[model samples]
Target: MKLEPFLLEILVCPQCRAPLNEADYDGHPELVCTAADCGLAYPVRDGIPVLLVDEARRPV
Candidate 1:
């Protein structure tokens, strides 16, 4: 599912509170932290952002 532009604008990283950028993770669209050190990818399920840190995926 696709996230709305307005929602994307308000979403931020849970770890660093940094701004998130639109990205693709595991063939699914997600909101990835912009901070290079905090590479957390928050999944978008059913067009809703799963912002929980425990549910976040870190880049290898």
Candidate 2:
């Protein structure tokens, strides 16, 4: 996921209210919230963010 710098700055963890970071999955990039306390990662596909927990996949 190629999130704009401005957008990334404002993105928050839906579960933890923490900051976000970028994580790569099998060469596929995504925006993730690593609030260790939350233990969930939000994904982005085809330039669209899939923020649902059910839509997310475990890193392979």
Candidate 3:
């Protein structure tokens, strides 16, 4: 799945309000928070981003 560049530019982490970086986790697309203190990973399902804090993966 591909997210539009404009959308990606505007998308931020719901928890930290930091920029999100596109990444692949376990072969699945994800949006990872750029904040070092809040490294949450939001999953991308069916080409749509799930930005809810409860659904995010906590940093290991």
Give the best candidate by lDDT. Answer: 3
Which residue pairs clash in candidate 3? none
Q: Which candidate should be chosen as best, given TM-score against the real structure?
A: 3
After aligning candidate 3 to the native by TM-score, how far in Å is the CA of 9 from where it should be? 0.9
Per-residue CA lDDT of model 3 for 1-60, tens digit only, reads: 788999989999988799999999889999999999999999999999999999998878
Write model 1 residue lDDT over 2-60, tens digit each, in one string: 66778778888989989988888668988889999998998888777889999999887
Q: Which stretches of candidate 2 lie over 4 Å from their true place?
A: 57-60
Could you give the candidate ranking by TM-score, starting with the highest? 3, 1, 2
What is the alpha-carbon RMSD of candidate 2 to the true structure? Answer: 2.2
Q: Write the per-residue lDDT of candidate 2 for residues 1-60, one digit (tens) a residue.
A: 567888888878676677778887768777677676565677777887776767665433
User: Which portions of model 1 show Cα errors greater than 4 Å?
Assistant: none
Clash counts per candidate, in order, are 0, 1, 0
The true-versus-predicted C-alpha distance at residue 51 of model 1, in Å, is 0.3
How high is each candidate's TM-score?
Answer: 0.85, 0.73, 0.93
